[model samples]
Target: MIVLALCLVDEARCWAAGESVRSVVDENALEGTPAALWDVDGAGDPTIQGFATDISINRGETVRFKVTTDASAFRVEIYRVGYYRGAGARKVADIGEAETFAVRQPECLKQAETGLVDCGNWQVSASWDVPARSRSGVYVARIIRSDTSGASHIMFVVRDDDGGSGILLQTSDTTWQAYNDYGGNSLYEGEPAGRAYKVSYNRPLIVRGSEYRRTSFWANEYPMIRWLEANGYDVSYLSGVDTARRGHLIRRHKLFVSSGHDEYWSGDQRDNVEAARDAGVNLAFFSGNSVFWKTRWEPSIDASGREYRTLVCYKETHAGEKIDPSPLATGTWRDPRFSPPNDSARPENALKGTIYVANCCRFDAVTVSADQAKARFWRNTGLDTLSRSQSVLVGLRTVGFEWDSDLDNGSRPAGLVRLSSTRLDVEAALRDFGSNYGSDTVTHNVTLFRHKSGSLVFAAGTTLWGWALDATHDDPDKQSAPTDLRLQQATVNLLADMSLFPASPNGALVVTQAPPDTVPPVASIRSPRTLEDHMFHLPVSVSGSATDQGGVPAGIEVSVDGGANWHPANGVSDWSYTFTPDRRSFVSILARAVDDSGNLQPVPTSVTIKVSGFARLIYAGLVGLVLGCGALLLAFVARRRRLLAKRRMMGL
Candidate 1:
């Protein structure tokens, strides 16, 4: 068990210690060999592609478009999609016969999963500044290349100053960035063009579904967007950018929705929601792995340095993190190694109350948790009082891509209710993960829990939760996830329940804004400050803190493996982490402090860890032994299942 701890002077002593966000270093160490080939596909149309200088641009704010095209001239048309009395999109701006600027495809420093490329540096098309009377919705740029007679469009969110009334749809543009195959590279594509460590949002997006729609707008985001828009749900549009940039705006809405495949997140994003939750804003995690990654935002300033137009995220690992204020290793949100030991590594499970189990994407029947088979959450699904969890609820495939579960090692929300789950068949190759992991019968959890502030956090637990509503993914021949009636009804119930109650404060007698803290707090290691010739199997103690100055520490975290992550330490009395190294080599350790007044350590304390190579070899041999034993056990289980099946066939 990895026990990461954070030690802070009792609040009364240190004005409360300061906050700390350590760069993360543990879990999802991202180990598959990167795609070995370059995927800079210079083919396709002579496209005029670009991105909105800002995805969540407020009305009246100047919005610019950067276009890169192989062709010399093209027409750029901007349209707004909403309930314009059923007219669909109303053309807002039309720049005709414009000269296409230079289109350069700069290579990325890493590899992506999908066969896409990255066009990091492209030329601008034209700036489409919004007028004072513009409405809040999704806007598109229709660019027509005159040379090749090809067309492409870009999607952006026109945000209202206060994010209009009712539900706030936070689009999963981060997921779009991950899947973007434009210029042949994305977070999920091949190398030489893939920006794995740091992805810049300075390029055009040409692969969001189709010309008539956004890439994942069809598969993930737009399906729900259109549903809410068509049904007149009093919804407002904003990208994940808004959540990361101006999370305070969440107060304007009663319901905050996390829409489709929202796998990535920044520390600020999580903090905003937690604050909102305590302040009584209902949260709807409509997507799986909702607060999965501890991400950080970067300003994409122009060459003049006078304008900031783009966004950046160096996930898991990056070389240029020395200048960042909250430089978290962009990867999975759990594990102490990524975060600082002083912070006790605030895993995704802390807020979401669930842990991602494994990577998946295939047909699986949906069912209720054994305890929630007849819970009120399922009252609208016609499964009340007489339902058995063994029975299929959706009658079709509902699980896919990724799934989450309640971790046995961690604590769930005080009153969390397990609503849904599916027994998954994982591979035996992941024996290192644990005994129950990488097997054919692990259960994933869907949960609901209410905070003391009278707010609720609901997790769908499946990446393809939207598929249960509509499966017509902008394609006629290509099928989508099954959209069953049961799932739709349940979704409706969820939406209704989310809005049924308003968030109420925890009733703190005195609540006020934390004072501005211009001065950063100091930090240092609390345990194992120095080590030499350490064996990989020998457990080590990790802990640290940040001076609160006059206020209490808002948080404390630590990073054990260099500066890959800054995990928030979790402990009520005292904080410290217990860790064991599995690999040989010298790793860097660091910790920081963040004051309640919002000041963090400008420079953290560091520790250089030295582990003997012999110890590493021993650890590797032990892990290999475990894997070998697990594989043999899997074979035995398979044989037993086969024998049972044969007996049943003989009517025995």
Candidate 2:
């Protein structure tokens, strides 16, 4: 008999009033097949493979699938990924014995310049009208050839837009599209110029068990899903695109979670997430290499003008913006030197607390320092009895492939604390995949901090942190680690601390949310107290400090000429900016700030200073003449000394 260890609430309380999470997992628990049966195996140009028309769909909405197959006919079996006893998924629908659901698709379209493969031209093979009562979670459609034994899977999410769950888990579908090299090339590799700058989501994610499955759902997110459901946590699901377009739904939840390998993000997605954080929504990033690449969404070539069907990333760090067709910078988020000029010059670390530093392929174990193991989050984890000899808490290989670090790069969140530290030897691991630092050793950290909005943000800072949560997850092949109870307990402790927990053993899950941050930050100029100044021919230094009810201000910006063009200041809270006016005149220096909750300072602190044009020109001429005369004198002296040395060598 298998024993359920975590918070498996009584079956009678599963359908408790105001609690939808428990009913979804407990009602009609379908007997699922073994893991080997559901997963596609032995693939080489799969005879049957397909992709969903959209990454996800809302309840009562229909989702279509585009399939390309060599088989005469095929069928689709839909399964909602979750935990049912030891089974990982529950069969939700079966579409077979239907002529319209057979494999019928046109040849995939390709763009020569970008090497973009668009399967949007293909006809929809099958469509599913999601029932209103269907649970919100990750769903997979297993396509099986009726004539042969070929089979593959297409995955998508079912979002509960109205369900006010405590947590909302956003899938890393954009990252999946980045690595999906289906027709010809992905964002990583191809023909015309090494890698494709743009990748279309309309094509099928290649049916490789070891590559696609490991990089996304199976290896990273599925495990976390199973663990959450098995432990009876109140959670709903959504896709990255949903976060961009329907981000207002995020405010309904008490917590927001970004799960596993969430690398690429559009500007809208980042803005919505940061806004949610400022609105007092707790954020838990169980991911790595997240928000690293700046991306934008574009419509497909189809007549429907399907927006967000294509993902574009130029990787300007290596190829520069010459190849980028979009007006916005499609490069790394940390780099601000785009030709068109990026307004928000902040890095991913500004919101994530930790920034991604190293590349993938390392399976390092997380080690909590003796001093840090005593934190409240580590309660009941047996770490309080941790002895000096029992240091290496082995088997929790949560840090791996690509990871993040708490590098003091100025954008780090205030009051950030490192809960776990693990030094990884990446000299060999990162030889093939490049790292930002290129150091022999890099440290990985799990970080947590309290935002001024009274919301807590926790970052696992690793890609495989979910791998330690459930045993039914996809293995990392050679580097697979066993699931431990200690990490599970820690997760439970974290949720409880965030004001989300089961009210009683047989009661509904309760969530206590704080009021949203609505007050704007106050900005004041701290330097050049004398508002009027006549400092001609000298650089003007402007500095200020800002106070926000939401904790530290997001950042400060300064404008020299009546706010026509503003540039980001050097720092937040206490900030500074120095500039020399092109022409000496009366210039109004304006300083403004934005808080962590996305509250902008309405009125800017202004200081008017006069730069005398006459003095500026006179100083310029005198400086130029003095520099020119000094250069000519030095040249003459050097020439004379050289001639004298030559004469001495020849005659004396």
lDDT of each residue in 55-99, candidate 2, tens digit only: 999876998988888777788878778776667876667778483
Q: Candidate 1 residues 525-635, lDDT tens each?
A: 766657655676778677765454544443445667665556545431135666777778786777766542234565777887786767567788899999999999999
What C-alpha lDDT, on a 0 to 100 scale, does residue 316 get in candidate 2? 75
lDDT of 2 at 373: 66
Q: How far off is residue 1 in model 1, in Å?
A: 66
lDDT of predicted model 1: 0.56
Q: How close is candidate 1 to the true structure, as a TM-score?
A: 0.61
Query: What clash count goes with each model?
Result: 76, 4
TM-scores for all predictions: 0.61, 0.73
User: Cα lDDT of all candidates, in order?
Assistant: 0.56, 0.74
The residue-level lDDT of candidate 1 at 532 comes to 51
